[model samples]
Every structure is written in structure tokens, then in C-alpha cells.
Target: MKVDASAGGSSQERSAAKASDPTSADAADDAGAKPRAALQDELEKLDERLKKLYEPIEKIFEEKLKPGLAKLPTQAQIDAARAREGEAARAREAEPSRADLQPSRTTAQP
Candidate 1:
């Protein structure tokens, strides 16, 4: 088998060219980087705009809703509500009805 030196030398030259061609690699890097940078810049601009737009609305909600919500039922009010429920239950039991209070036979047993 005859080995071709010229063919082998050309392959070595190709490898050296690939290794040394920084401009081509840098161009490729730049091509990939440009769109990513553009997207990042757009996202940052959108985030800043969103923050600016929401700030006043957030402040308004905090100022308006918080105070009104604070005025609603504390723990004491909740205990009073439970007490009222118990009183209502006792009143219903004590009250008399014209109709029979017994469950019908057609209903399923508990």
C-alpha cells in the first residue's frame, strides 16, 4: 500500500488552520451572542417597565385595602360568633313545633 504524503500534509494543514482561525471562531461566537444579548436587553427593559407600572397600583392597594380589612372581626368577635351559634342551637331545641320532629322510616339509619 502506497501512503500519499501530500494528502497527509493537507490534512495537517487543515487542522492547523482550524486551530489558528480565531477570527472565524470569534465571528461565530458573535453571531450566537448578538441575539442572546438583544433578548436579555429586551427582558431587562420589560422588567423595569413592569416595576414602574406596578409601583403606584401596589401602593394604592396597600393603602386602601389594608385598613378596611384590619377593621373586620378579631379573635373576640370570632368567640362571640361561636357563642351566638350555641345560643341559637339551644333556642331551636327549646322551641316547640306543630309537626313531629322524628325522622321518617324511609330515611337511612345513621
Candidate 2:
């Protein structure tokens, strides 16, 4: 196969000439800038959409969940309940055994 080096060289020269031309560079920049601007506009729109989507959820948390959470028992309430349970347990332990309440089977019958 015959390789045409001159054709490749001419194409490289054309590319270099295109790059060196200010008008061609400006056109290229304009071409790239359009898509970049569109992408940036799309990103800004998506950001607004995301904010809109999360706003209701954030409001629900603030209005409903926060108040519900606030109504829940505090650490002090939990500690008080635990103290009452402990006291009840101690009272149960202090009470007489079942055997103490029952009559002795070893007692003689008349």
C-alpha cells in the first residue's frame, strides 16, 4: 500500500491555519459557549426544581415532626419512670414470700 504523507501534512497544515485564524477561533468559541450556556441554564433550573421538591418536606419536618418530637417524653421523664420501676421492684422484694402467707403443712391436726 502507498502512504500519502503529503496529504496528511496538508491536513495538519490546514488545521494549524484554522487554529491560527482569529475568526475561526471566535466561531469555535461561540459554538462551544452556546452548549455551555445551555448546560448552565439547565443546571440552574434543576437546582430550582430540587429546592422546590425539598421545600415541602422541610416544611413538614418543621411544622409536624418537630412538634411531635417536642411532645415526646424527655430524658428526665424517662429517668423518673425508671426510678418508679426500681422502687416498685424494691417494694416487691421487701414483701413477704408466698410460703409465709400459707399455713404450715407440718402443723398437727386435731
Candidate 3:
């Protein structure tokens, strides 16, 4: 907040100044719009800059990520792999290995 200088400045002097100039009211109204117009232009420029920042990320997702995602395995293939691994584990658990039947004794010679 500012204290307007009262020295040599009064309402009577201000009213007389406004009375002498008819266009001052219109100029005041235009002064208000100048800041709004400048603010609107600044907002538009910021919007354009923000959109430019996202363009490269959007392009990368479309060109690189989408194709790599398509090449990945489907749900059905992943489930089938589960069954194959479970069957191999069962076979290994049920059978005794030939290496287990032939015992080898090795002595480390230091």
C-alpha cells in the first residue's frame, strides 16, 4: 500500500484536472485492459511452451514403446511356460540321477 503524496495534491485539484480532460476516463479504462491483454498473451505463450515439452515424450511412446510392447509375450504364452516348468520340476524330483548312483570320491591334494 502506498500513501499518496498530499502536498499540493487534493481532491479539488484532481477533480479540476479530470474536468479539463474529457478523455482521461477512457484512458483509464484502456489502462485496465492493457494488463489483461498482456496477461492473456503471456498465458498463451506458456501454453505453447508446455505443449512443446510433451511432444518428444509422446513421439517416443508412439514410435519406440508401442512396437516393443507388441513384441512381448501374451498372457496365454506366459501361462503355458508355467506348466512346462512345473512338469520339468516334477520329473527331476521323481527320478534319481545316474551321477547320484555312481559315487565319486575326490581328495584335494594341497
Candidate 4:
């Protein structure tokens, strides 16, 4: 019990020492300011980098990708493929298998 009391008393003293020191407040303020300033600088750098990077990608999409997709598959090509598929389905249906015409036979069970 006495050991526990001393341990608690030391923690209270440590906190009191920190609260009494003016340099501790300055340290906390410096720590907070440094990270926020670094983050603001990084954010500005990333903003400029992303803007430069996206401009070429936007040009490639508008100039190349859009024109390529427009040239693919006219109306005549689609109609021809559909007509060929219809003829193949008709041919397969005209020839029915002999097994398909057979009837099932089952015995009665107890």
C-alpha cells in the first residue's frame, strides 16, 4: 500500500512539474505548429503535382479513346451477325435427335 502511494505521488509530481514549466508549454506549441506547417506544405505540393499529372491523361482520353470507340461496330455489321445466328438456330432445330422422340418406361414399386 505504501509503495502504491509513492508511485501515485511521483506521477502527480511529474504532472505538476510539467504544468509549472513555461518551456513545456512552448514545447507543446512547437510540436503542434511543426506538424501542421509540414502538412500544409505537403498538401500544396500534392495539389500542384496532381494538376500537372491529370492534364496529359485527360488529353489522351479525349483525343484517342473517344475517337477509337466511335469507329467500332456500324449498324450493318450488327445486323449481319444477328441474321447468321438466326440461320444457325433454325438449322439445329430442323434436325431433332431420335432419343428425344422416345417415351420413358418405368415399373411400379411397393
Each candidate: RMSD: 12.4, 6.5, 9.6, 14.2
Off by over 4 Å in 4: 1-30, 73-110
- Candidate 2: RMSD to truth: 6.5
For model 1, the stretches where C-alpha displacement exceeds 4 angstroms are 1-30, 74-80, 88-110
Candidate 4 similarity to native, TM-score: 0.42
Q: TM-score each candidate.
A: 0.46, 0.47, 0.38, 0.42
Model 1: per-residue Cα lDDT over 41-63, one tens digit each: 99999999999999999898899
lDDT of prediction 4: 0.81
Error of 1 at 24 (Å): 16
Compared with the true structure, the alpha-carbon lDDT of candidate 2 equals 0.86
Q: Give residue 100's lDDT in candidate 4 (0 to 100).
A: 80
Q: Give a tens-digit lDDT track for model 4, residues 1-110.
A: 33533236678776765655646775568566989899999999999999999999999999999899898988999999999999999998898877787765565768
TM-score ranking of the models: 2, 1, 4, 3
lDDT of 3 by residue, 67-101 (tens): 99999999999999999999999999999989888
**Regarding TM-score, does 1 or 2 come out ahead?**
2
Model 2 vs. true fold: TM: 0.47
lDDT of 2 by residue, 5-49 (tens): 434668877666666665676557956788989999999999999
After TM-score superposition, the amount by which residue 35's alpha carbon in candidate 2 deviates from its true location, in angstroms, is 2.5
